[model samples]
Target: MKLKSFLSNLPARVILLIYSVIVLYPLLWTVTTSFKTTNEFYENPWSMPKSFQWTNYINAFKEASIGSYFVNSVLVTLLSMAICMILSFMAAYVISRYDFKAFRWMKKMYLVALFFPVAFKIVPLFQLLGDMHLLDSLFGLVLAYSATTIPFTIFLMAGFLESISKEYEEAAMIDGCSRFGVLFRIIAPMARSGMITVAIFNFMSYWNEYIMALSFITTESKRTLTLGIAYLMEVQRYATDWGALFAGLVIVMIPTLVLYALLQRKITAGINVGGLKG
Candidate 1:
């Protein structure tokens, strides 16, 4: 029986291994390509280079305002992430804990919101930002990102909140803790997985968002990394810097990797932490 089971699993394991290699190969290729000099790239696109052009990173950082664009993305992503997390947490908390009519509507309504395509609202957004003199501004972009993301974030957070036991709330109340204290000290900490997961999703979404950034920002100085990459593409027509372009892409990917690496470990811990009273 054990031999039969191992044989049956072998095919599935082989297929999965093949799939993993397929997915990872392109990423490896991109990293290797980033290090190659232009001449080396042209000479042998696939083979390893004699020496890595570390300066490609410096060039990408300097030439196309990639560093400035990186800074802009950080500013926008942080503000957007903060706004989305705070608003989602509050809305989810109220709807889950309180049994009011309007709060009830929020749960069903946000579900409907997810069904609608984001493009449907872009024109109105463009006009609204323009009217407020916020077009092309980071603050405006942050607001746009936060507003569009809230409904979904709220839904995710509320689902998590709904799963948690209200017995915790009752126990806290018996101990003379106020509603606000119970929420902050107990509920919020227990929902760490939801918060981190939603926050990371929001961060990745806004950080990589190209369309909104392009539609809103025109000035080179104010462009986010997404826009900066597009700008790099346009600039490449006149001057070839494929190495730098690849370097910029690698830079853009680093933050997302770092965030997941740091936060992913906590997602499982968050759920179990609630059970440990001490």
Candidate 2:
């Protein structure tokens, strides 16, 4: 029976292995290439570096102005994620806990927003930002990111919130806890996994987002990591600073990698918990 099951699953295991390699190979190549000198890369392209060229990272930071972009990205992503998560949490709490007719359409609206492409709304967003004198500013980009993500963020957290037992809130209220207290002191702890999951996903989205950053930020000083990478690519086309280019790519990828590594278990648990309860 064991042998039969193993044989039946062999093709699936093989396919999964192939897919994993396909996804990981380029990431491995990029990491290897980031540590190689231009001459070494040109000579072999696929071979491992003779020696790790740490200068590639230094040059990427100093010469490519990626350090500034990195800071900008960090600020924008952190602030945007904070705002998105806070608002989404509160909104999701209400939507899930309340049995009101008024709130019924709100979830549907957010679902609609999920499908609504930001591209179609860019013109209005641009005009509104410009009117508010926020165009080409990091704050503007932060606001744009926060507002746009709220709908989906709300949707995601609402699922987890819905999965939570209202008895927790009821008991807290009986113990003299205010509604706000019940939310923060009681419900928030129970929904910790969901919050982490939301934070991780939003962090990745805010970090890697390029199109909105590109559209809103015209000033070189305010550009995010994504813009910095794009600018690095343009410079590399003529300069051929392959080492710096790859280093920039690696730098861009590091945060998301760290975040996922740390919170991957919570992400899985959050989803499973929500799914089972729902």
Candidate 3:
């Protein structure tokens, strides 16, 4: 009987196995290739390394200047993520809970804003940033990323806030909690999973972002990791180093992988529950 039940679920298990292999194979290939020497790679790209070249990672960091780009990316991603989430959260809460003039229209406008392709905004955005003298600066990139992400973030967080009960807000206010305190204490905590989802999604997006970085950042010193990776591609045009290239990719993938691993449970929780009832 047990074997029969297991067999009943066999199709689902088989599908999952296929999906997992599809998702993980490229990452596995990249990591293993990073350890192969140039000769080993040219000899047999599919085979395992005869001798692991840990120096690939060192060369990526030192010679390729991934070290500086790593710091730049970390700073830009964190700051932009923080600003975007905070602004999105506040806007979402207000739209969900309050009734004021143009409130419905405002939400509709944000819905429309979500459809505006970011690439379309580039010309005007770059011009505006140039006028403000923010081009090529980290702060400029932060502003650009935060603005680009806010509309969708608001759309997500508003639904999460709307799903929460109003009684909690009333109860907190009656206990002498200020509006800000209620948000920080009650609402924010209840919405933790949604916030984490947004943060992780946007962090990864900004961390791996290339287009905006390419358009806005011209100075080599201000380049992001994504931009630095592009530089490696440019170097390859002159002299290809597949090992270091793969090593650089592994370096780029590591932080995102570690962050998601740490917060994997939070993602499932967000999908499972919108908000607490009480």
Number of clashing residue pairs in every model?
Answer: 0, 0, 0
Q: Of models 1 and 3, which has the larger TM-score?
A: 3
lDDT of 2: 0.91
Order by TM-score, highest first = 2, 3, 1
The sequence of per-residue lDDT tens digits that candidate 3 reaches over residues 1-278 is: 99999999999999999999999998899999999988898899889998889999999999999999999999999999989999999998998899776876888888899898878989988998999999999899999999999987888788788888999999999999999999989999999998898788898999999888989999999999999998997897788688898899998999999999999999778756763221
Q: What is the TM-score of each candidate against the true structure?
A: 0.91, 0.97, 0.94
Candidate 1: give the clashing pairs.
none
Highest-TM-score candidate: 2
- What is the model-wide C-alpha lDDT for candidate 3? 0.90
- Candidate with the larger lDDT of 1 and 2: 2
Cα RMSD (angstroms) for every candidate in the order listed: 3.5, 1.3, 2.2
Cα misplacement distance, residue 204 of candidate 3 (Å) = 1.3
Candidate 3 similarity to native, TM-score: 0.94
Cα lDDT over the full model 1:
0.85
lDDT of each candidate versus the true structure? 0.85, 0.91, 0.90
**Which order, best to worst by lDDT?**
2, 3, 1
Q: In candidate 3, residue 171 scores what lDDT?
A: 97
